[model samples]
Target: MLVYDVATRTVAAANKAAMRLYGYSREEFAGLPITELRPPEDRAPFLEDFDVLVSRDGPASGTRGVRRHIRKDGTRFSVEPTYHMMRYAGRRGCFVVVIDVTEKEHSRELLSRQADVDSLTSLPNRKRFNERLEQAIDDARRNNTGVALVFMDVDHFKDVNDSLGHGVGDRLLQEIASRLSSCVGPSDTVARYGGDEFVMVVLENGANSDSVAGGACQCDRQSEVIAHVMRVFAAPIAIDDTEFHVETSIGVACFPADGDDAETLLRRADLAMFRAKSNGRNGLQRFTPALGKQADERLSLSRRMRVALSNGEFRLEYQPQVDLQTHRVTGVEALLRWHDAEHGSVSPATFIPIAEENGLIAPIGEWVVQQACFQAQAWQESLPGLRMSVNLSPRQLARGDIVCVIQRALARAQLAPQLLEVEITEGALLNAGSAELLEALRAMNVDIAIDDFGTGYSSLSRLRRFRAERLKLDMSFVRGIGVHREDEVIARAILSLGHALGFSVVAEGVETDLQLAFLRRHGCDVVQGYRFARPMPAVDAYTFIHRFNAGSLVPS
Candidate 1:
């Protein structure tokens, strides 16, 4: 609390509390100028405002909002001052009270910053990035320049998070954010767009807007920025004393060429990034018209697939697997087929990947399991030993409920577990939770086959650890058995290795007489392909199996 003379603008009196706050003695504070309480930069404005307040005819007794005040030690803090017009010892004076609000203001500022930042990496979040991108686009339009958006995704990031724990994954993301930040300029903005994905907006002044040879805008500045970003991942990232060679797929979309608005630019950049990943990852791509068309087609197909599943447009075809020595159908593999009302006979090769990407595989896979189990139960009346082999996708295994899904399917159909076989690719084994899922299936007496062997990076240690019942030679190797010597040698080695490890070898895509002879000579336990019979519907498969087993249908 203090009192100041209106005429002289000097402090007339101060209470003990005011002396303690200002770090001054009573004698020193008594005649101090009122402006001295404010910092030097604020003192001039304080006097002008004070003069107007004193000249007013009415009493001025209200809060003056918030202002900065310097203590005797020269430390500045925020305070709210309230003053009243009054008389002190027969002299015109003002009585004032100050309330410190430094801590409250600080808390508000911190909350504002936290809303714009990513909690893990301390980079700007997507919301802040979008806001800045809109502003950049506006500025570029005025300056006749370009703004390039770079969308990046960490390749195989889920493998890192699954194999290593999420703790290591978090640390790895932090390191990636730091490396990305080091590659951009002051004018550029880098942000964490969400999980394993980062985005950047680079201002390209005087960039060439003309189309290049490949239909891409020739933006030299953006090219340089992308090159710098690529080099950051050239070296291995070391985390917790372990080195990992991380890879990223980047897509570039420039303003006024790929898109004019922020939303359009972001979508196009995302489409281009997927193209980079499809071109085998660890690369970069620019947005083009053809890429946009492809994305639209993919989106249309994905929507159709969801509706197809609900409307029963999907069905299963079984390809018979024959025993080598007896030439009899031993088991059948269930293959999914889709026949759309508008576009008939869509190939599995085209739609399966889309299913996996859009997360439709989980529901589709469950339906396949239930149908296959019921079919196998129906076939048991004629062929008791026939096994129903169904492919299990890596996505399903990662969901952590695949074993229970299979168990429920088998129990509902009253099918014996021994008659069911779950076929998984070698690539699926590399995922986390797969081994445990396979072990759980094995515990229930269900057979496990490593499908498409030699098509992935399979180590002897993984083979020895998983201990699958069967190893299916991929069709690529089987197709080259008679023509390519390298393929023949690989096929022979795989057969020898499979037998040595007590795994029954099943040769896929065996279409020729020479290929069949080669596999029979090498002791391949089973074979399935066009040589026997093409994939048939359930009714056709049941009749074909009866005819083949009764020695009526002969192999061509």
Candidate 2:
């Protein structure tokens, strides 16, 4: 406790506690300026505050809140001081009470850190990232500079979690966080947004003479940072005894160009990240106005697709697969078609990706399986040995209940398991739990076909890891047959590899005699394309199947 003359701003008396707190005896503290208790830098502010308090009409008797104070030995600590008007030795003065709050302030700081940082990676969590991003944007505006928000997603990270386990996944994330931290400058902020996504904020200031012109320096700096980040992942990350070749898709959004606010910048950066992934993973994409439009359209389509299946707007069309040698209809690939009341016909290429992204693929996929199985069963008597091929999405397999879904669909339709061929792309095989799912399907006597053979991350090692009965030559290669020598060579190599592995190769998109003849000459087991027929409704497909087998639908 102490008393200081309010008008003179000088200490008049002090209690034992006050003397000990400031490392001063009562004699030494007496008549000293009250501002002496505060640090030198704070002394001027203290006097200004004192003037304000004394200038008020009423008595200044309230808390002064928390502040830093210096002791006689030059040591500093935090204190909360409260004062009240009083009379000391018959002079106008104020009695002050001081409480040390250094530990309290330290504890509060620790709590704040815990809330702002990710426990797994020790990087700033989304909350802190947002705050920092906003500050960066404000700074950029004031300094006539630019800021870049870089959004990144680990490519096929889910597969690692599913195949290796979550422990490995966590370790991988930690290592990624470390590498990302090492690549960025001290001024930049790196954060783990959530899951496999990470984000960084880079400030572009006039530090470089070239940056004085415009945003070009900002773009250059962002590119340099991104290049560093990419180089860090070039080598395989070793965790435990296993090595993983990790890849990331990056998206960059710039201030004053992509967006002005934190929220807009972050959202646009995420959109650009998706664009990078879609344009084939392990690349970078910059934000553009067109990407925003595409994102809005995707969201709208996703909303409409949610009620599509329930409203009976979805149906399956059968495209016949012809045996190359026999020229007989051996099976049909079930393709989903949507004829929206408002949008007319929506292409699968357009809506399927949106469905996958929004998680509507699960229910829609189940419906496709059920309807296709039912149709196959209905044609059992007419096309006795016909196989029903259905496309299974990677997202469906990721759900971990794909085998159960297919089992239930087959049971409901009473279709033979061997007669059902589930066609999946090479990309699907890269997912976690996919191998187990395929094994379970094989155990159930279902045939597995690797669709889109020459296009994905397919290797002999992966192909040998799982058992599949057929390989569908992707139309991209088939389209280039005779037109591109390279495509033809790849198509033949795929055919040879499939045959050598004891799998029948089915060529898709055989729209012309040249393509068909090339497949037959190359010993393709089956062929399906527009040359025979485009996809048709179940009723029309049934008639077409009969006509096809009767040789009446054969092209002259």
Candidate 3:
């Protein structure tokens, strides 16, 4: 307990409790003002203004601000401070009562962190990011300068979450956020914003409106901030000392010229981001009027896609994955196709993302799995022990229902689980949930293969964790087999690495003898594409396999 004179601004009397809490003896504390108990930075403010606003109080209410007291050893702790007018034995003064609430302070700190920071990446959360953006815009407008907002999110994030364990997936998000912060200037703001989504703001004060507008020259600042960031993100994000492919679609918008307010600018920038991902992910697009129209068109397409799902307009196609060594058909991957009554033939590349976006991917994917299993069973008599490879969408995998669907499909077709291989992208194998699902599939004797292995950003750590049975080399690398040494190196590396890891390598898109010889020499176990035969109907595929087995049909 301490009695402080408001008139003289001095501590008049103190007890042993006060001395012990403060590490100050009676002589040391005598004649000192109450402000002396505060840290150096807060002392001046307490004397100049805080005293006027905070002192002369009853029980400390929410209206009274929280303050801290510093010990002689320089340790500061939060205290609940309240004072009331009282007369002491000798003089009249304020009787101050302080209750140290360090534990409550710790709880407050945790709550504050949870509100402002992303739990997974420890970066600024969406609310904090928005606050920073709003502040930047205000400052930019006052100074007649520009503030650029960069909206970015990971590409194929669903694949990572669905394939890898959630723990690794979270670690991947942290890795990306850490890399982004490294490239970001101290004055700029970088935030996680949300799952796999990030937002950044860079302030350029004293800029003219022309420079603030989204144009070719907006990227010409002396610091070249955007270019530097792009260069940094170009490298694959490394996690646990292994590479996980990282790519993002970035959208940029400027203040004043692009949009005066936060909502307007964010909306425009987000539209541009959608354009980048739709055109091709892993790129940047600045806000423009045209892109907004395209965005509207996409929204229309998404609505149409929801309708298409109800009408049962989706179909499946099978592409055979052939064994190179034995010259036998190992499996066929089910592919989705859709023909819109109004738009004619719509490519999977176009409608597939829309389906995923509109929440139709799960049901559509379940249908494909069931249909493909039925067809595989129908052809099993002619092609005994033939396998069926079905592609699992990221959404289906994220929901972790693909395994149950696979079990039901096998039951419906009376197909052996060994003859059912589910093809998944390397991106899908990075999260804990995916690992659990894959482990379940493995336990059921279902074959698991990582589809398009080399093309996507991959992690070696995940490969050994997957218990995968096959590695399907991407067509992009296979097409360049004889033409590019770099492609040859990558292909050979994949085959060698895969074989070393005990995974069968299925080289895709083998259209020429040169490609075939290259794959065979490199020890690829399987080849699939036009070089052997195109994806055929179930009946033709069975007959083709029978003839090939009888030595009547041969590779061209």
Best by TM-score: 1
lDDT of each: 0.91, 0.90, 0.80
TM-score per prediction, in order, is 0.91, 0.82, 0.60
Question: Hey, what RMSD does candidate 2 come out at?
Answer: 4.4
Order candidates by TM-score, high to low: 1, 2, 3
Q: 465, model 3: CA deviation in Å?
A: 3.9
Q: What tens digits encode model 3's per-residue C-alpha lDDT throughout 284-397? A: 888887777766776877877777778887777666777777777777777787777777778888787777887888888888888888988888887878788888876789
C-alpha root-mean-square deviation, candidate 3: 8.7
Query: What's the count of clashing pairs in each model shown?
Result: 0, 0, 12
lDDT score of residue 235 within candidate 2: 91
TM-score of 2: 0.82
After superposition, which runs of candidate 3 have C-alpha atoms over 4 Å from their true positions?
1-250, 254-264, 273-284, 456-461, 537-543, 546-556
Ranking by lDDT: 1, 2, 3
Best by lDDT: 1
